[model samples]
Target: MPVWPFKRSKADIDAKRLLEAVTQTSRQPALFGEGRIPDTLEGRFELMALNASLALIRLREAQGVESLAQAFTDKLFRLWDAGLREDGVGDLVVPKRMRKLAASFYGRLSAYGEALTSPEALATVIARNVFAAEAHAFAPALAAYAARTAETQAGGELDALFTSEGWPAYQG
Candidate 1:
């Protein structure tokens, strides 16, 4: 069989599917509103980072499919980059913006990981990142939701990441 230059690898396809699931979950309206995540661009980005971080955390612990995780992350960033372009962000400035976005994502990932150890810490982190405030009344609810998601993903099969049903429903 001849090599097909344009064919996507299995990992790439799986990653795309997983990314789609993450994106759809992040965009659920229930996640945004008064006492919930803000519906602005920054708020959307924060939610995406949170959902993606949860999936990546589970992926890191799985025995195999490490490449799938990497592929998922690569596709995610590409999607963000495309969105930036669509918004008329100049090519000359996309790199700087992406770098800042990446930094924000990684910082959230670290804070979330550490915060997961305690409910109070998790709420604090959620208030800080998701709500962008010192203390939001609904931050604790969001924290509980995140904790539930992490637990669900931890017990789910790797294939679950590719489907919406794999993630816990948002109760916010």
Candidate 2:
């Protein structure tokens, strides 16, 4: 029998679809409802980082997810690059901007991963990132929402995720 391959073409396709799903979920208007989030570039990036953090963490436990995770991260940065280009950023500046964007994403990922270890920490992170100057009264709801999403994704399969219907509804 042949040895298992390090990369699977099908998995890559599914992962791309999954990345798109996560991206769409992150941009749901409900998340920005009633001034909850600023709905600007920073706000969109923050929400995407949060959703991507949760998805990547959950996806890491699945089989053959290594490449998928990396591809998802790449897709994220590609989106950032495209956005920069659309905003009239010069080619000379794109690389520097991408580096800064990557740093911002990694910083949020580290902070979020650390926070996910405890409810209190998660609340604090959410308050600081999501609410900013406002009170964190919604932290509990947000935490519950994140937990539900993780649980739902954990139970799902890669093929299922390729379909639009596979995505879990945002509970927050």
Candidate 3:
């Protein structure tokens, strides 16, 4: 729960700022240039991956641990796949509306898939929701989703605290 270098809230992360940075960094003759959009799935993943890697480095430093890259990578992928599911047992349930929007974006950008095969693909995944108007507005929810996902996938600890077969269990 260390705050990002930019700000305390995700809103502070500023999609516009991120877009501008990406735009500037990926300009022609730059590594990420040529038909790249910072708002795409692949683009977002790349951003997320970078951020995650940075966070892991910070975490290791704080804990005074030796290279945690492998552990960090393993946990990150698990959290990435679990993706916001607080409950360890179920699929990561994306909101129907968001899912549709994502599908639409993906479909529109499908043609760019080949062009996105670069390292940018990593951040693109993390930044997947960056383009969603609702995302900036609901960043807490998204963070919660990501936190829950990571916790659930990390181990069985949180599971006991959240679920209950109490009273009338849905034994159906």
Candidate 4:
């Protein structure tokens, strides 16, 4: 008997929702509008990190639901790993890539987590990571977007997420 997609486990359903939300958050046009965020690999990675940090932080705060968050993060990393392989990263260097990616994720997560607290902090972190201190041109817009997104994510419910089957409408 073939398994029906709608009959998936709660874990599977939640993972799908989380992935969709993350991708949608990353693609929010306000992010790239007027070049606030680059439309390149580095820019994409930074945007994903920002969204993941928000999701992970919220999940951690929800009592008894942290494991689900870990599962979601694991799935995202797995997708990244597969992408690396598809892009011609050798098997031998895959482990190294994983390590590098993990480090980058954690570092950005930490920076972004702190950055979300205030516009000043957000600007500093954004300048360091996204612009490499070259400029703070987009930091203000990016900070506003993060603040808005963080507010939206704050009201999301972990349990309800399993049944929420669509991509999020990101507001910048």
Candidate 5:
């Protein structure tokens, strides 16, 4: 059988769907405002990173889904690359920016993964990363939301986790 250039692998398709779900959840209007996540680009990226990290954490835990998790991460970075180019980032600087973004994302993933076991730590992480402050009034609520989301994903079916409506509703 000949390979079709346009044909995507199953992992790719699943990853795309998962990424879409994550993006949709992160972009929810209720997640942003004066008392919630900020409405700035940094805030948006932070929210996206947070959601993606949660998905990745679940994927990593699921049996025989390592490839899917890797694909999801690859597709996410690719989207970020395209977005950067679309935003007028020159080719010369794209790599540098991507590196920075990757470092930030990985750092968050580590911090969040470690902090997830503790509510206070999670709240502190959210306040520092999402709100860019030492302690934000909404950090506890956001942390609670993250905890609830993590629990939902942990108990959800893998197939359902990749769907657009897979994530729990954000009441923030």
Candidate 6:
């Protein structure tokens, strides 16, 4: 079993919806008429984290690391909880259920320490180091959560949810 609550189930319809939701929500307004939605810091994090976890799962599997994928997810979820505790915003920032999904993704990525030092991480690295990396990897997932939130609060006006510069900032 995973150290976290990220159950080891095969990807399904829900996962597909979740992934699509992440992409739709993470999209920035068309950049310079390029029709390219800029990947916000949050979005970047989610993509990186998810991709890294996938990579780690592959690597571990190739090396015969038993249940490594499960372990990775568990660590990510644990770290996510820790990050929330350090910031004291678990309840404030995300709902309980969605938080689990986000945390599970985050936990999975965080498990790949060696991968963090690689060029891919370098390409994905933004402002901060470890913290930035972790946050960036979870950006898309967070965006999905935010999209869901916008839906609940304002019927999913995602464009309004994002800032003119691209991503939203904490008012406080």
Judging by lDDT against the true structure, name the best candidate.
5
TM-score of structure candidate 1: 0.93
Poorest 10 consecutive residues by lDDT, candidate 6: 28-37
Better of 3 and 4 by lDDT: 4
**CA lDDT, every prediction?**
0.88, 0.74, 0.35, 0.74, 0.89, 0.40
Q: Compose the digit string of candidate 3's lDDT tens values, residues 15-50.
A: 233333323322322213233324544555543543
lDDT string, candidate 1, 55-123, tens digits: 888888888788898999899999999989998999999999999999999999889888887989999
* Residue 52 C-alpha lDDT in model 2: 85
Error of 6 at 107 (Å): 14
Model 3, stretches more than 4 Å misplaced?
Answer: 1-37, 65-72, 82-172
Clashing pairs in 5: none
Instruction: For candidate 4, write residues 1-172 as lDDT tens digits.
Output: 7676566566666776787777776777767745578887778878887777767877776787655787788888997888789878999999898899899899988888877889888878877887788458887767677776666557765653333222244444
Off by over 4 Å in 2: 1-8, 131-137, 158-166
RMSD of each: 1.9, 5.1, 20.0, 3.4, 2.0, 18.3
Count of backbone clashes for each model? 0, 0, 17, 0, 0, 13
Ranking 3 against 6 by TM-score, winner:
6
Tell me which residue pairs clash in candidate 2: none
Query: How many residue pairs of model 4 clash at the backbone?
Result: 0
Better of 1 and 3 by lDDT: 1
TM match of model 5 to true structure: 0.93
Q: Write the per-residue lDDT of candidate 2 for residues 3-120, one digit (tens) a residue.
A: 9956567556766787788788877776675636668877887778888887777766677678878877877788889988998999999999999888877877777777776777
Angstrom error at residue 52, model 2:
1.1
